[model samples]
Target chain A: DAGITQSPRHKVTETGTPVTLRCHQTENHRYMYWYRQDPGHGLRLIHYSYGVKDTDKGEVSDGYSVSRSKTEDFLLTLESATSSQTSVYFCAISSGVWQAKPNTFGSGTRLTVV
Target chain B: EDQVTQSPEALRLQEGESSSLNCSYTVSGLRGLFWYRQDPGKGPEFLFTLYSAGEEKEKERLKATITKKESFLHITAPKPEDSATYLCAVLASGSRLTFGEGTQLTVNP
Candidate 1:
């Protein structure tokens, strides 16, 4: 278990409403990632941060936005929620620059958009 | 696109039955391969990392072996507590890791 926490462990939001999920870490890892797990799609990377204020898009970056203004926090926002976004979101942090070491994940956040 | 595919989408084994889960990958240049176990409603827990072909690593009842194109996770005499979804991911040319759908293993007592 990593010293990572995701705020709003569970969230329920209606369609077309704005929602945000937060990931906080005390490990001070340089690399952080956000992933979404669906029923059959496995876990897909949504976005990642290499450093403070430096971020990049991942395989499934549509309909989502992330901000990492500081080293310890990363935020993911959905401008308008959709039913398709209903899934478990996981936040992970790696201590290495290129994932030389395994990444540790937080407990996760379960989000349901109706 | 770098791809990872795990076989036997679901598996059921009696306690103490040894088995192996397969993860086949195709990437431009493999930097690393990762193994993770994910319980229901929880995030994945890291297990092992295999860096190159013919590399092997082990811990407790689990063993991970890698080749050029595929990797195998061997579980020896597993217990009910070992039941979980086994996920395999690969780090390709860049740092992004691509994941497989995962193999769900259920060890019955």
Candidate 2:
């Protein structure tokens, strides 16, 4: 298991409300990513950070935003949650480049928007 | 577009039964292929990373092999504890990965 920790393992929020998930790591990895898992969709990358304050959008970045002020913490925020945003969110950290080493993932956060 | 597809969406096997899971993919340039194991209600655990065709890696009873367009995870004499969903992903010279839906494997004792 990695040293990554995700807060609020399970969450339920009403539609059109703000929601945020936090990911903290102790490994001091240079890369961190947020991904959403849905039935029949596998894992879709939502956003990623190469370093503190350096972020990039992934394939499914719509309606979601992420910020990393320090090397160990990354935050994913849904300004106004929707039913479609309900899914299992996973946070991952990697010490090296994607091709150089495997990413270590934290236990997922199950979110439901009604 | 890069994509990954895993076959046999679900599989059932008896304890000690050896089997394999397949992951087929297409990418403009393959940087690495990764295999992961996920138990219910948990995040995925990394298993192996293959860099190119003809590369192979092994851990305990699990072995991963890769070719140009696909990768295979072979389990030898699996046990009930081996039951989990197997996920495969590909990194195409970028930081992000494209994953497959995964194959859910059930090993009954």
Candidate 3:
């Protein structure tokens, strides 16, 4: 029940096409993250932003990129969509680093690349 | 790498049945352990946060306890609505949360 929302709740795009997912938070949290959820992989972080204009790659950052223009918005972009990139994407926000406080997750965005 | 493993990939309990789920983890310095409930198609809902070994926290029918290397989620008199995937994650020294695969529970009526 956090004040987090993901845009384009659902999207479908062709392979090799560009795709971007948006995460917006009204809480002004300092940390924002993008993760993809797969059946056996659970949730794997693709990218994270600690502050505006600051970003870092996660375990599965390959082919994925993120940008934070402001504290309230985090964007995840897939250079070129691939069938393997199809999964439920979740955006999480935390007031403090995950080590200090638990993060709040958005409902999620389901993306399918055919 | 810091890792978390949850057991009983899937569980089924009849109404009123009691059970427990396990979350085993390996971390350099465990700052905190958290439990979350995620219904299918919905983001996880935070349940409890345990700060240290021998610590325990409870809400309604769910209770969470932590030890040096693992954590336990015990369900009491579970109801049909108590069905969902229970996820466990650890907050390590640097504030990164490494999550477990989760245990999917189904409480039949």
Candidate number achieving the greatest lDDT relative to the actual structure:
2
Interface RMSD of 1: 1.8
Over B1-109, each residue of candidate 1 has an lDDT whose tens digit, in order, gives: 8889999899999999999999999998999999999998788999999999999999999999999999999999999999999999998886568889999999999
Order of candidate numbers by lDDT, starting with the best: 2, 1, 3
TM-score of model 3 (CA atoms)? 0.95
Best by TM-score: 2
Residue-by-residue lDDT tens digits, candidate 3, A1-114? 568999889999999999999999999899998988899876788888889998998888999999999999999999999999999999988888543443689999999999
Q: A11-61 in candidate 1: lDDT tens per residue?
A: 999999999999999998999999999877878889888899999888889
Instruction: Give the C-alpha interface root-mean-square deviation per candidate.
Output: 1.8, 2.0, 1.8
Tens digit of lDDT per residue, candidate 3, span B23-60?
99999889888899999888888899998999999999
Model 1, residue pairs in steric clash: none
Q: DockQ winner between 2 and 3, please give it.
A: 2
**C-alpha lDDT values of all predictions:** 0.91, 0.92, 0.90
TM for every model, in the order presented, reads 0.96, 0.96, 0.95
- List model 2 lDDT by residue over A27-95, tens digit each: 999999998999999898898898999999988999999999999999999999999999999999988
True contacts kept of each: 0.60, 0.70, 0.62
Residue-level lDDT of model 2, residues B32-76, one tens digit each, is: 899999999899998999999999999999999999999999999
